[model samples]
Target: MKAGRFEQAQRQHIATLVRLGEGREALAGREIIQRSWRRCVDDYRLDPSRPRPVRVLTHEALVDSREPVDELLYVARAGVDQLFAQVAPMGYVLLLTDRHGVTVDFRGHPDQDAALRRAGLYLGADWDERHAGTCAVGTCIHEARALTCHQREHFDATHIALTCTAAPIHDPQGRPIAVLDISALQSPRGLESQSFGLPLVTLYARMIEDAYFLHRYRDTTILRFDTTRAFVHFNGRGLLAFDPQGRVLAANGEGRALIDAHAQRTPPAPTQVTQLFEAELDDLLALPRCEPDQLRALRLRASGEIRFAALVEPRGVRSRQRDAAATDAVTDIATGATTASHDPVATTSTPDLDRLAGDDPAMQRLLGLARRLCRQPLNVLIRGETGTGKEVLARALHASGDRAEGPFIAVNCAAIPESLIESELFGYLPGAFTGGNPKGMRGLIPQADGGTLFLDEIGDMPLTLQSRLLRVLAEQEVMPLGAERPVKVALRVVTATHRDLAALIAEGRFREDLYYRLNGAELVLPPLRERADRRYLIQRLFAALAAEQDGAVQLRADALHALLDAPWPGNVRQLKSALAFALATREGETVTVHDLPESCRAGLVSAPPLASTSATSEAARVRRESDDALADPEGLALARTLAQASWNVSQVARQLGISRPTLYRRMRRHGLIPPNRREALRG
Candidate 1:
């Protein structure tokens, strides 16, 4: 907006272009930036000197962009808040953008909101390479990695005053869904100033991505590991989601990289857990029986290097069905069913509690317990992440229980004001207060007499009110504000919250006794991302949506894949809303990728590799590449070490800090030694 700044920017842009055209060798060091600059000018046809105003989307459009990643936002909320808290003091702002490079969420000091908004660091601003030219978020989107686009690296001179660091958050399938960035309008000069911030941005980005991965695969068998055993359970860098037979379904970015490290060549990703580690399915399944702190030692298949791994078994399955196999005892198993001696429930399908319990293993287990305990006179506490349908679970429990005929009153302790919560929950006698109802009103507890009382967000209730609620739950009696006698009520209380009640108790914000009183039986509902039955639920919800419209809105494969890849932070509720939105806006009969809302499209890769050539060509190409690498300094040192060690594989492996298998693979790749020479060395 300032004339002087614009003039300065134009000069810098012109000078930078001239310097780039001069074929300066130093430009090689900034190849990534220079390549992006060329793409901006040649491909996108962007003019750096003619700086454009920040493109901000309308509120509705912003919400549409935010919709698909609502689940990712939920998973990332804690990370974003904590990151902002650390950077806000230094005048830095945080921006989380969808894969399209539009900022969906942001945090900055209130005092600087206006300035930040104008700088395009606020929500709804498009930072796509084509829209805003070279920037951290946009470049990160293109590169599919993390980097710092310092002030001068920004294409538009208008953005030269801002230095931003950003990293991409990829889904489990390696498709990017979002970008996490931290930027400052003004920072200390020189690139070294970013040393502290780049790692922080990239770290949180990976953390959020890994958290989302875990959330999506929570109900399956997950094998997590790290180089060292100590930190494997507490935020391990490698995550591999496998099936009961030890086949890898998916892996996080770090996990994939770790697997690739053991391979001599890269063609297809690893398909089995055994390809990377020498561990069997039985070993993996039995890891859950070990102490939580005691991690199992997993050795790399190639080098035999040790990696500490922890197994996350499927939650809440009583008689878990690992695999299906036909035995002689159960001949002609197709005709009826016969139980095997080694494995039971081999022929029968898993039991379902009710319609509300989808095929998710965790949900099935929890609901099974709830179904069995419904007739019992016991209070229940449900714990789950936000948007996990805790209230729905409580309602299901009530409907299936002996109290189904009685009234079921659901209350959100967080929705009511602290001042009114007392009267609203406990009721008040006439004239108890100046504004009291003349006829006297019964509280929520009394209204649920001979039934169920569902208290949602119970963690937010005021500390003072927790005591009274606890008393009601313990005594099955309620005392009105101004009544002479207490009222007796037979109601089962169920409470749920996204917060950690134990943490709250330590903070002295929640009553300890009240937690136990309501926690007669604990049930946790997994978030949608973590649910094993997402595919089933998605189809069921879409079919229901179609029935609601009473028309066929066909979903194409592209559009459906987009839906499946979504972060789904809001769980079942969010998925239904997205399907509905796509169905309503789609043209003709079929829904294509373009028909989905912007948020839903965040996980869709622009143009993916459709096919690959023969393995022979790939192997040849890798051989050639390795042949060239042998001329490098690293190769020369390795060769010298091999000669010094008399070509002993183990000795060379130990000296090179690699496993013998890896060393052999590398040697074979480079065509280093012949079989005769290797045999002579062994002799």
Candidate 2:
């Protein structure tokens, strides 16, 4: 084979660009053109000084050719094929060229086949720099940079109808391996040609670079950064890079958003790549790094603004000294125990309490209060609707308390049989009752001696047991049946009840004195219906449960809407059960509306309109139903009196012909408890 006049000219042009730079940049340009040139030069085994001989680089030649030049050309052609197929719907063509800029593969619309072939724009077409100067494929290859040329940008008048963008794809060593070009018919009025064509070309080039890097350097970390390191090019979401000194270096788009929210302020720059390197250095130097079994995320205040970050030290470097110190600090912070030394783990591995995963203000406040309250041994009383997770709050309290290492005994007072309630709580002595143990057993109160005792449905306890419970709580001791002496116990008591204790007291069903003792420190857990955090709860529940289940079972948009609209009489418990049921019923991938249980689906359906003859009749019908659902005589009297009395409970009670206690009880029953007072009602 021999080289043509155009091929000789292109080689000269590429050689000129290589002389203008030095080292990596210069080498990069030379490698790109040399790889492309080798495809033709080696395939025909020709000298460039001779006249050019043409041959199409088929996929078979690429796969079967033992030569590296043939393999590279084969890969380039394959990539061009894929790019053309991907963007074919947008009416674009993909072209691949040799180092001398001759078209090796031209992929595009079949409708333009005749026109393109006639214009010498098909495979084996001569597009060397000499023949097509300043064009996308030729100029980008000649300049060793990405270029976009549209319509009249072509030096050859015959190529005026095309808008093309070409980017030089580089290998891991920063050598240009091939040029990726996307060309479309010139669109004089639309922006799609420029926007889609240019971006698509850039993307294809990046994909090639990424694939090459991953293949060549499998062991080394290949961190891909955008112009700024604000968004890393990989799939990991919200990844934030931290320095050894605990400074934030760079954050991905999602990570930046989280950091901004935590900090409650925006960063000065949109993206800063240098910050990432600096932070990496600081992170590496902070302490002896160790890989964590699970990466604990941390959010801290920097420059008076909070930012989210994670410490990811490689595995096997964590020493016992580091682990002990870190564990001690975390335990102290969580349990309100003695402060531990400022170890690296203490400083770097603390979990972000702010990111505990809920969006409701009430939930946020509850978490904040839980964090502060965890440091103490105060008895807590959580009052909420039945399915509102009284137990979850109790567990959180226990886990966050000093006695987390000790037992957490939870007893449901209402679930226990009346005859067994006393024995179950206070334990029993040998021969104290029929079938009694030979040796006296420790009761729940004693079992929870070093930790927390969660008494659920305390209001439902029989009056006889209430007095005994009050005695145990007041004396901090319990006397088992047939025991001669009381056993002293050290434990925190947390009680929950769905019933109104004051109403029980007024009915003479509960002891008033006992109520005050248990209400020492109250925390009212809001019912799901009343909680503003339903959306947050849904997200957290899905995230927590989805990982355990087999297939994809995300809530449908309609399901989420339905969940938000439904009155959750069963609260959090019902929500979890509903999701479980939906997951079980999911046919293929998604949890559709049809997968929901009848009860949930029914709840989702809008209630039917009441029959009416006239417009006024319909309005009255609607109002009547609304009142029936939300306003009884007790609620109406309370609402009216509160409105008239200027929202003062005591004044409203006096005006509403009820005692203050009676008014409060009715307000709670009617779900009229004010947001502020609801916290008070927790006790």
Candidate 3:
């Protein structure tokens, strides 16, 4: 216990490690510790006998060093308090340090504050791996993972008695920004007692990372997913942010792993979405929402290997206001008419648009071009994939154009039957057909007189109807099917389609002259997957849908992850269905994963049932299960899972059947937290 004795023990240990040399694989420690020990000996050449003095920065330097991360400091304050609160009862001192391992913040019980300070667990203490050898704060930053440096596993003699558990907090771009560490001057000899330390610390660390990333890239497209839906919110590695062009802008640790696996590389480089998968981003964006069981195999472009992953889109515009003017928006395509407003309709308010646009350079440019083009009377052709909001963009253009006061009528060419296509555009006079109405009805073209006509899916229009539509556009007049003369009608023409009109022309399916007539001023709408503003759109839709029910409904963290991971082939239309399903199924205020559709629940991440085995083998299974059981605190997680199974441990155990005894033991261990009625009776 004395300093002299500790020094002697460290020297003997170092000499033992040196004698083992390359055979250090036989050492008694975790791989992380063994690796750190090798680095101490071979790289740093730290003297085991000479204990280095703990370095604490001066007050002025510490304050200055933290200035650049003022926002981060503010964001982490709550997490710091929460982590400290969780570990304080266990007699642990919490030290939060910057990337370089200089303690920027510290929390400890009043009675033990002095002892912690003397142990260099106070603010400003520098515990970087090089300076403090193999300790938690320093080694965690070096490894970029959650770890525990048990007593004697530390490389320095003076630190041999202290046990430290730490987890790294990375910035949006996956660089370590800070480290959350819990340490004690002395602790139990066995590591098992402190098993909850790393998990608890890592959980809080990820909570902080998620908060920081959401705040940092709040306006960008943040894609969060996992191989299975289980534990995604707790797993920071599956979160990623991308720009409008499908370039990966940022990723957390797990996200990097998913990217690497799919890319067939160690750590994938900053690459476009296209380079990583054989499917072009646009093509993938076009496919229907694939269920977890049937997830399209994402082919690695480089190795030609196939992998499956669930993707979530966390960006989009808020649901548009559905007044009479904007009635029948895109979702009404089943009936054929996707209408628009006569008022200077706001798709999303200017402020909301600005907030949604944020710093996205691509969106800013798009918005700028749209604003300018709206002022002109050009026959605007909006090109985009189906469900990419061509109608919405068309409405926005009409609202901003000189014809803002005129009516805006949207017609889905694809939704109209061929028999009615001609009469639908050019109204027929009385008795034009055997079943004709006693009085002729005004066609959609004349209905748009003195306003705008939005032709949605214009490519799907019949070839004969295209010629009639072109004549109306070229002559600025509409001729009723049975009328004796043409009636002049003034209106702006806006056409949108997902099809490549040029290809249609070559196939003799569409007219080239109609294409040229509609292509006066062109704007292409990016699919929801490609937009960086996806997050805003999602939240906005949820907010609007919740309002429709006159109740507050929101996606819980996991439910949001489920929504985000869905590949919305129908784009906004598909997302609306999922949100509507959640609203209908959700029990209370929060929409958890259970409320999500069956497609979202498919392939949920769950541990397999424990195998039936001999009594002797069962014990080893229990031991192995114990390794992961303590990775999360037993009280809350255990209680929730128990409640889900209606307190059937046998069922729960079978469901998470890693080991039989492990589940029972854990339930018994945390019995008081959620004391089962039957278990209490047995007790």
Which candidate comes out best when scored by lDDT? 1
Cα lDDT of model 2 by residue, 61-169, tens digit: 4323223223234334345667878877877777765555556456867889976665445665555554444467766776787767665444443454567788876
* Residue-by-residue lDDT tens digits, candidate 1, 389-445: 676677667766667777767777877788988887878898888888988878877
Backbone-clash count (model 3): 16
TM-score of 3: 0.41
**C-alpha lDDT values of all predictions:** 0.73, 0.56, 0.68
Once fitted onto the true fold, the runs of candidate 1 whose alpha carbons sit more than 4 angstroms away are 1-6, 18-28, 265-269, 289-292, 317-683
- Count of backbone clashes, every candidate in sequence: 2, 15, 16
Evaluated against the true structure, the overall lDDT of model 3 is 0.68
Q: Which scores better on TM-score, 1 or 2?
A: 1
**Alpha-carbon lDDT of model 2:** 0.56
Q: Quick one: best TM-score, which candidate?
A: 1
